[model samples]
Target chain A: MTFKLFSEHLLIVVAAEVLALAVGLPLGVLCYFSPKARKPILWVVDVLQTIPALALLGIIMVLAGAGKQTVIIGIALYSLLPIVQNTNLGLLQVDPGVKEAACGMGMGRMYRLIHVEFPLAFPVVFTGVRIAAVNAVGSAVFAAFVGGGGIGTAIYKAIRIQNMNMLMQGTATLMAIAIALDLSMGWVEARIKRGHSSMKKAPARRN
Target chain B: MIKFEHVSKKFGKKQVLDDMNFEIPDGQFVVLIGLSGCGKTTTLKMINRLIEPDEGRIYIDGKDIEKVDKVELRRQIGYVIQQIGLFPNMTVAENICVVPKLLKYDKESRDRIVHEMLDMVNMPYDEYAHKYPSEMSGGQQQRIGVLRAFAASPPIVLMDEPFGALDPMTRETLQDEIKKLQKKLNKTIVFVTHDMGEALKLADTIIFMEDGKIVQMAPPETMLENPANDNIRRFLGKHMNDDAVTLTVEDFMRTNIITVDKHRGVRECTERMARTGVDTLLVVDESDKYIGTVSIKDIRLRGKNEKLIEALITDNAKTVRRDGDAHECFDHLLNSGDNYVVVLNNDDTIAGIVTKNSMAKALSDTLWGDER
Candidate 1:
């Protein structure tokens, strides 16, 4: 029974993360480029984040007719704020001199963004994505209350029947996953930062 | 050739650049000189479209710059700034070849051009090409900035106080190197400097700016000799004092002084000296090597048959070089404990004479009014 619950929980968390990234990245880039669209969109996302996780589950379940889909939607919305804000902040903070130099050298808008601005802004944006992922992992457990499936269900079951052993295993596994993800994301962020710093250190060779 | 046609730019309500018009001819080193907030930098930026003028147009090679593709246009015209603005991410060689690479120059061609530019700027390719901007001194970085601007051998280059951040000695050395390079390359260069001396030394023509308007534009000598207005006169402020003292040697040197060989007759030397109404004459060989000097009194006392040039002449007379300063001549006369001094040229030829009276007159002329 514990094995079944663990497998189900793992699958649900993975699926939720993938969904959030797929939807969030493009939205973040859009918000970063479009100044007019950013404030209103971010305001809506901020308000969504204020909704209690459990109530969000309840509200989503009623609208989407319950189960895993409803919980995933709720968690994804909750994760949007950090990712959007950080992406926008990171791109905006890229050195204007670099951008101007690129432009002066006849680099088109697309090329400048891809080669100069995007690479430079990657680390900060990655931090945002990592935060969002961690938030998603923690929030996935709440989905189990609505029968959305995951370790949260095991914990809920343990609570219903007063099973401390089952509760410890589910809670422990969830903590392990979160810690491992956080550390790996941190490692990836560090690698990107090092790459950027080294590139800066390298003399700009012509041709 | 570049021409600014009645250009005016304003940032909000503050007019940073008033209606300005100027034409820079091809292959000329034109320097714009002014104080801070004089809009020289703004004028430079407008050429590359980094700052667009609110009114009027700029033409490059007789076509409106606004009509050209800005990115391509900028790639062809090089720019160097006071802060350098070298891409910290790029190596020295890479920084130098940025425009060429952008223009799609092949790897071999780009490498060759980068090396040539580095060499031209006095930073040899091997030692500096692989180094980053942060690893170099301010002067070296500034040199790299200049090399980068010339990397593609652009016909036109604009520099905004490129050496302004360097130490005085480095600035002077770099300024000389830049002048040499510009002479060799013959590029149309617009060099911006706040330092009047630098402008005077480098500019083929100077544009003096005030309140975003060009107050006067003329060659350095003309500007120094006859400033356009009172403001310009005040701005130039006693440039004659700053004129190198070496130039005053010509004015103070005595042209009527005579010289004789060591074997010359006293009577003949005295006759020549008396006819010239001078007491002293420098003794020299046929080749004009300065041997010594003879006085009229020496000739009168010593026998006429005796060699007055050698027997009674002062062999240890004080002397100055032809290029020596008028001030130095005055100092020598006052402190030498002698009435006169001989002046020699580089070849040891007798150039002229400096006496106590002449030194005093030169000093007084420099110090007092020219009422006489």
Candidate 2:
């Protein structure tokens, strides 16, 4: 029973994160290029994050009629802030010299963003993605209040019936999921960073 | 030819380029030099429309550059910068082919161009092609940066203090290589550098700027002989041999000396000597410290069985510190049987060679005044 609940929780987090990334990446690029659009777009995502997870899901459940889809939408909205903000920051932090070289070499805006700036900015962006994924794991617990079943349902029932054993199991499983997601994503980020620094010795000496 | 007609630009209240008018003829190596705010870089950027002028127009080959699409124009013109901004994510081959790929060249043609470009810098295609920028040295990265610029065979190339960040020795080597490449490729190169020595070495025509205006434009020899103003005279400073009573060895030494690595093969050394028309090649170790000198005669006599020139190096050549008195060095060269005296920096790297011909040329410049 605990194992099945854990998988369902994992499913919600993964699905929500995928949806968030798909919407957030292009929105971040849009924020990077257009100064006028960046203000409103960032403002909306930042406001979305300020809404409490349960209240946000309750509102989504009212609109979408209390299902897993409503919970997924709520978690994805919550995930947008980190993903969008990080993508914008990553592109901004790319080496200016590299950007200038890209433009000077006749690369159009989209070409440079895809080929040069985006690749260099990827490690920073991955860190953002990791943050969102871990946060979403914790946020998915709100799914129980909206009939989107997961470990959260067990925790809710344990709290209502005063069952210590069920509460401990649900809380422990949620914590484990968060930790696992953080560790695995952290590993991937470290691998990307290592690839850059392994050959990072000082330039060759002139013969 | 690139012609700027009444071009002017302003950033807010400060004028960056003030009605700039200049014509660069075909196949000339022109250098733009000035202080930090002199607008030399701004002027270079305007050529490819990276920064559009507030007024007036620029013409390339008599066609208005403003009418040409900026992207297409930039692709047809090569550019290199001081920071050596090669893409960290791309391999050396991919970095070189950036412009070619933009122009939509096929895979076979791009590979051939990459190999040819690497070959021009003596970097073996097999070795460096797959290597990332971080794996290479500063000098090697800059070489690849240069190769990337020229890969598309642009008719004109622009360099903005491209060797500014390198050590003096590496900078000298790159300067020589670039000058040779520019001549061979016959490209009209507009190079910008703050170092007058770099400008003098590489430019056929030198355009000095101040306060967003062209202070003077002339050949290096003419500019040195008759500077347009006191600012230029001050800029020339130590290079003006006329003002000195006790000149140093640096003023007399010709920096265009051919050098060979100690580990290079005997055949390669002979080829370098023959191509550059030098009898002796200064030998430096891997760290680039001057070890000794290797002569063509020594290689012919004792190098028959030798594989590397490291074995053929000998310390018989006379040496002098770069800061040594020019007259004393001249006397030493006349008295010694050696054809030229190797001038060494404080750390013992080869600064230059003070051959009799170079001294004669220096003396002629002193005597002839305004004449070449």
Which candidate ranks first by TM-score, i.e. highest? Answer: 2
The residue-by-residue lDDT of candidate 2 on B118-209, one tens digit each, is 88889998999999999888999999999999999999999988998899998999998999899889999999999999998899999999
lDDT of 2 by residue, A1-207 (tens): 377777888899999999999999999999999989999999999999999888898888889998789999999998898899999999998877788899999999999999998987888889989999999888888889898888888999999999999899888888988898899999999999788565334354332
DockQ each candidate and list the results.
0.20, 0.28
In model 1, the Cα lDDT at residue B111 comes to 88
Candidate 2: what is its chain A TM-score? Answer: 0.93
Residue-level lDDT for A140 in candidate 2: 87
lDDT for predicted candidate 2 compared with the true structure: 0.90
Candidate No. with top lDDT: 2
Off by over 4 Å in 1: A1-35, A54-76, A143-149, A187-207, B230-249, B252-372
